[model samples]
Target chain A: MDFVLDYISVTTFWTVLFIVHALLAVALLGALTHQAVAVWGPVRLASTPGGSAPGFVTRFRSVFAPSYAGVVCLLWVLAFIFGAIIYTKYRIYVRIPIEQQGLFKTLGAFELKEHLVTIGLGLLPIYWYLWKNARNAVYDSSRKWLTIVLAAICWYGFLTGHVLNNVRGFGS
Target chain B: MSAAAQTQSAPSDRRRIFALVFGVSFAVLYVVCDMAALPMFTYHPGSDRIDLGFTPARPDEGPAMYWFGWIATSALGAFVLALGAALLPQKAGAKIPLALAWIVPIALVPVLIYSLKFYWRW
Candidate 1:
């Protein structure tokens, strides 16, 4: 116990958590991407990806949208929860330096990213509801659009976090 | 329909109303809170304190972050509104346009981007 505690300093602990956060975000990005594409137009997805040798893109967009609702919501919440935790450390270390160094664009992008993600967070419940009701024609339009919006948010967030991590976290 | 179907429908109806109301209201309220800087609470990272309303860097601390509080404000306010919407008679909810779920937030995207105009390069 003493040796393990000594080896993993606060910095190491935060770094590990940061990596976990990034991994969760990546998983979330993939899940949302697949759902968004599949939910378009006809608002249909294969019950079991049944098709006659569909192309890469078609196969990519073939997941059952309803099955994804719960997972997407869970991942979104987990990703944000982990993000909120590491955000405290980020404010103290990375953000202040980024400001002092005059990386306004990068900082600004993150600012936008945070707001967008928060908006995306607020969208989760409805996204879940719409997807759950995907079979009902009344919700089809709302389902498609909401999925696209959530996907867009996840993409922007993943990209911004990637770039910022490149500037900071990836080094370790 | 059967009794089971009728029983299931009401709660699901209320849930759909709640989710949609929460979605639309949170988006609108978040933008207002963020732009106005009227968060439910503010977190000063340096001092390790979360104060109610906005506060400066106090005696010895770095910048204060209102982002968390902004989220809190929108979420809590939207929660109250959603509960009310869900509790309303089903007839009242039927009048709500489903498009508003995605539409309002989608429209506000640009406004939010505009709000961050301070960070724009040119």
Candidate 2:
């Protein structure tokens, strides 16, 4: 049992973690590519028929769309799982020295709070907008811009918060 | 306009131009953002410095390199999407900048992961 735990605690584990990370990264990229083609390719091609764009977009989307959503959701879940594992295995947050503990703990707590809140509250509204506006003829560029902005905000929040929390050496 | 002149005019050219511009611009932006986020390349932090077997004490250590790698990956995806968009057929007047918009966050995921990992260790 100790050996197993030790094995799990090695840097090799992180290497594996990174590999899985890379795979999910690919899946997420593929999902975005698939979504983009589905939503935009047809429209672009409609303007330039016999130009090969439309057929390619249709084929790519057809191949990709079926698994896109599932893969994306899986990617997020895996990321969270890997994050939790790293946190526990390293004793990173809990083991910090008393003087240094407060800041690290605060940052980690804040990040957790932020992610939970954004996924729980923010994503719902975004999804609602996508669904409701699916066929709406309104040519509101602002809506697209708003979605992009919100995604950017959420992404930055996640990035900065994670970086700040991890700055303190594990158990420093 | 003369009859021959009208026949030669392409109604869809404007939309095609727009898609090309949007697609190309998004690709360039993705590349730039990735470059900005990447750590300047350096030797891998030696294993002996810490129990974790690697240490990157500063942003210059590996951040920029990883960021650019991520951007490259996402740029590939955006390229595919853009090509598909430019090739695929659709409604006569659909104006969605599909490939461009999706490329933003797709390129962002690896950067985010790198940031998280760096934070976990930094």
Candidate 3:
């Protein structure tokens, strides 16, 4: 990869990319968590019997939930791209040797993580649609269910990626 | 909404449900197929290395057959399932989300099994 800054070394290039990917993943984790909570455990305002006004966090979550679709999709895809770049170095240095060592569980975790990332990408469009139209009562159940499933996928990918990173640090 | 309007919207609603089912199921099914090593086509970059008739010089440096093959396999699977659901009667179509609520989770089982199988050598 050609560095825009001549002073930047190849190691720095990849390390920066890894850092950016990590940041994006962290943001995605927060967005999905808030959205999931909003869907499955919405808080009602105690002051109102009709539940017309939700509590502060619940109100924030509701606003945050619908807005997350676009941001999550963008960041997730960008993270995937960064990961693909990082994977080239990882395959030879980290993955192959680890596999040779018979540490299949860690390898398997990384494998699943990659697949889940791609699968989540595939769900992006529908996820956005459901969130965009969340106010439509008829689609409420579908949206909630989809939100829960996507959040589950994100959590799976996040946790697995963390485990694999611990097993073998990125781009080593 | 009037009764007539509700009736008119029913088919569209069904179509939306079918679309959602296809999208979500395709994603899950694709990964499951990949995890289970059920690629319709095989190309190991390090060995023989010819996937879909394309060869990469090194196994470590080659096209990812898991990706292309998974896309092909999952697309076919999702297409067939969606078509079947689309043809179901209107009442049956309405149940697609409910069906998926359970079906998607069941579809995830193979991924877990595949991961464990490698670890345990079972």
Q: Which of 2 and 3 is ahead in lDDT?
A: 3
Off by over 4 Å in 1: A1-7, A41-52, A170-172, B1-12
TM-score versus the correct structure, for each prediction: 0.88, 0.34, 0.73
Computed on C-alpha atoms, the DockQ of candidate 2 is 0.02
lDDT per model, in order?
Answer: 0.83, 0.41, 0.67
Predicted structure with the largest DockQ when compared to the true one: 1
Cα lDDT tens digits for candidate 1, B63-112: 78888899999999999999999999999986777788778877997998
How far off is residue A156 in model 2, in Å? 3.1
Itemize residue pairs with steric clashes in candidate 3. Answer: B45-B59, B46-B59
Candidate 2 structure quality by residue, lDDT tens digits, A1-172 = 3475565765565546645644654554455455445544333325665565445646775543323444444554565455444534333333344225445444544443333322322122222333234433231232344334333443454555445435643323
Give each candidate's interface RMSD in Å.
4.3, 12.8, 4.6
TM-score of chain B of each: 0.85, 0.34, 0.56
The native-contact fractions of the candidates, in order shown, are 0.65, 0.00, 0.18
lDDT of 1 by residue, A104-123 (tens): 78878888888888888998
Per-residue alpha-carbon lDDT of candidate 3 for residues A1-172, written as tens digits (9 for 90 to 100)? 4555587876677678778878888888888888888888776536666656555776656655777778877877888787776765666567777877788878776776676666666666566766677665555666777777777877888888777777777555
Q: Score the docking of each candidate (DockQ).
A: 0.46, 0.02, 0.25
Give candidate 2 misplaced runs (Cα > 4 Å). Answer: A1-9, A18-26, A33-42, A47-67, A89-154, A157-172, B1-122
